[model samples]
Target: METFVCAGCGRIYLENSQRCGHCGGDLEERPASGRGIVYSFSSVHMGARGMPTPYLLALVELEEGGRILARLADNDEGEPSIGDKVVFSGLSDTGPVFRLF
Candidate 1:
């Protein structure tokens, strides 16, 4: 994946930007590690069409310092836990998803 990085301040954003939101400087696109730790998560019993109910939604703190709000896939490792290492698992129609590493 790619992230927007501020050329002036080095701030990273998960989304593309014409300019840096923090410094109003030029933004550049860079490859993202797509690796992070599960910061927090919640189970949603209700969701949009075709979305699996009772799926996990989480905040992943990327190794690059950028955080992404994404759906999480369960692993044989048991329930999701705070600070669990995860890796990008591609995307569903809804959004990007991650799996426990």
Candidate 2:
């Protein structure tokens, strides 16, 4: 995944920015490892337009540092849990999608 890092404060951001919103630091664009642990998640039975129902949404803590909210790929095995390892599967209409690593 693409992220912007604050050169001054060492903060990472999912969105690109010329400067850090936190400390007015210069932002550098870089690629992320796309590996992380599921920090938190929720099962959504009701989804938005064009989105299928009964899907998993999670807050993942990247190994490099920083968190991202992404959609969990549909798994035949079972649902994901907190601390479960996940890897970037691909992008979607909404945003990034992650699967069990």
Give the top-scoring candidate (lDDT): 2
Misplaced by over 4 Å in model 2 are 6-26
Off by over 4 Å in 1: 6-27
Residue 6 lDDT (model 2): 91
Q: 10-54, model 1: which lDDT tens digit per residue?
A: 876656768988899998998987889999999888987886688
Give Cα-based local distance difference scores for all models. Answer: 0.83, 0.87
Which candidate's TM-score is highest? 2
Report how far off residue 30 is in candidate 1 (Å). 2.0
Candidate 1, run of 10 with poorest lDDT? 9-18
Model 2, C-alpha of 67: deviation from truth (Å): 0.4
